[model samples]
Target: MYKELFIHRLVQSKEPNTLPKLLEGLFEVFADFQGITTESVSSTLIDLTFLEEIRKLSGNINIAFGKTLRDIKCTVNDSDFRKHEIYLRYDSVKKLRIVSVDLPSSSLNKQTYNTIEDVITAFLKQISNLQSYFNELENIDHHCVVMEPIKPLYKDDYRNIRIDDKTWLHLEVTPDGSATNVHLIGQSEIWQDKLQKGLLTWDQDKNIVENIYTIFDIKNQSVSPTLIPVDAARKQSSEDTIGPTCGICYCAQLPDYPGLPQPLCQNMNCDVYFHKNCLFQWLVACEGGRPPAFGVINGSCPTCLQPISCSDKDC
Candidate 1:
């Protein structure tokens, strides 16, 4: 019965509603298929992800089957490639075109494929070759000996490279092998002030692996040994400190710390304090939370509804 319906729909493929209606009817039976599900992201685009291993491949895959083959777009799962996405489009009945195959870690030897499966397999093979590159990152982590280990963000090219217990370097290596969009994550005032004053700088022309060493050295050398740590500077009790309690936690000091919260709402009238980590979590869970850029998260202050920001790094 399903086969007959699908064949009839194909016969009337010129009808705008035919495919959707056919898919809708198929969902009644196919929705129960193990490991496969469909989602309509738009009138012409549908996304599907394999929940469990299917043919030894599993992750998010978006398939946009438009009226013509030229409009069809199939993006492979990019969990491993970071920002280097692999897009497959049906350019002809006998062949597929792979877009952006010039990824640094990917081999761009072939740009055309005879079949969708062939293109997917080729990309996956290229991505698998990046294991060595990932191992190189692990080696850098070992050499840096950061207080907190480095972490790779999900579906992102940036790495949160910890400089110390408080300071972090949010780094991204562009596809062309240049280090760009380097940002510092630390005490909001200290880092922002230094950035504005030009104390910290990044040279994008340099290689990312090489720049890591330079940036780490520059930041460390710029700091004074005689200066006291922020937590150490606070010799007073919570009651003695003149700071607003955390809007979310309602605590004067973050857990296990003697000093008051490090983050504050920007509003002059609503002087609220918040632990950096706490604020980040709250913002992420809140309704108007903006997505994370590098390591910084933007959201409104809970108390005054004023714009506020926080870093995800642990101090």
Candidate 2:
């Protein structure tokens, strides 16, 4: 009975809805077979209808189907038996889909299958990476200290000393009652000098002494040797650049230390600079009030639009 109804639907319908109707008819036939009402079968088969659509869409097309479906290809034929290609692809979010049909190779051809395929592929890869990143971040403990300042040693010249942007100096207590100094940038002359001068002392036994010194400095001299946490320190380093004061805003202060507002770009690799907040407003005005995304803004220098690459020369 199901087969009879399926054939009838297939013969009557002019489009792909035939598959759905046939599946619906099958539920009715099965209901009769099991002595159940057709109305009950219709209500119970709703979810199955969706599954059937997925199966049918995935079967006839050369597509990849998993939790996400993609890369659907279909063949079309002309009246004269000439064949053409129709391609459909799922979007990056997997919420939208795009379809494209091949055009004849001509000078006026406005679209190409390769271009569509490339766009679909790129979007998928981007969304996939974003999903993976968020998933990984879910496991991260954001409450832990993200940044710490390395202690400056006596023999260390403060000129060439800069904090590394990527490397985190984690303080760990070792088994030998000493602080283990695991050099991340490897053996450097600056590091060696600092280690010898007792600036970068990781000795757990000396923690009390260091604490005393820090407290004394804070109490007596009004100087806190530790500038910022590891994360803030890195952020400050990235924000600081040798530049001129902004002509319009006159905010010329470079990010010499943490807890200070970052300056805006003065010019392309030139001196003029503004506060980050000021620059953001400037950009919004320049772009007619619709600023680009934060990721794009962070990715490039405001002055040059070149990619920002932070380096660790000193700290």
Candidate 3:
């Protein structure tokens, strides 16, 4: 039995640049499904359409990015041939559809899926390119910041984030400084209580005013499946370009910037790359006469007086 994963009500966009963001909002609306990953099952190739859309935007939006990414599709196989095929498509009109089907068995030796769960798991593995697509979608380039999951920034201990985790919350701080789309993961019933009463504050300074806390009211909150607008995800705009070497440490091998391969220079002129830790130490040193650093900063480009690359999305 196959069903249609339909994205309800399509919205037209005149600007291609805004498509990615719309796509983002679209997924946020249906972020409540539970998908599992299983290896043994034979599956079909997934659609690659939506992903192509993301790639184009990823190049322009330069926060932190992952090469891998998003897509659509349908088909059938014979009885014995237990084949699982999936495809992703992004039409010129801007709609995404994922359709699954089971055909009659072909041969006696071919394996067949015994249950829908088995089929679903195989389907997830095929479409598991989310981490990459999202990596770029939430590119700090699109907003004020993507608070790291590091200590003092964002902290959580609800283990079991595997592809199969029954209950989880994949929080993405929206442009409005709110986690509007809490990927309600596997099941909301399980984690709703904790999220409502948990001590979840955004910064190290947990004082009510100093910290950006998250309020969870499962009963009152409404985050419809939404679209991702690319207006907020474009690449560097000349002034944000930076050097190949760290202006401070003169280093190229910057510490791993999570999803990014290396640290980026935000200076208009390309000069250096730096380990974030190195950059932080340098920034701290520069603020010698200043008080203990408080929040993140978008330092000025030594040459242009503009903000540097990968510093802060808002700058």
Query: How do all models score by TM-score?
Result: 0.34, 0.19, 0.21
Candidate 1 least-lDDT 10 residues:
45-54
Better of 1 and 2 by TM-score: 1
Superposed on all Cα atoms, model 2 deviates from the true structure by an RMSD in Å of: 19.8
Q: CA lDDT, every prediction?
A: 0.49, 0.35, 0.32
Q: Model 2 over residues 81-150: C-alpha lDDT tens digits? A: 4343445553322222335443312111233333333433443333333332222222121322222222
Better of 1 and 3 by lDDT: 1
Model 3: residue 256 alpha-carbon error in angstroms:
5.5
Superposed on all Cα atoms, the candidates' RMSDs to the truth, in angstroms, are 13.8, 19.8, 21.7
RMSD in angstroms, candidate 3?
A: 21.7
Ranking by TM-score: 1, 3, 2
lDDT of 2 at 223: 38
Best model per TM-score:
1
The runs of at least 3 residues in candidate 2 whose Cα sits more than 4 Å from the true structure, single-residue gaps closed, are 1-277, 280-315
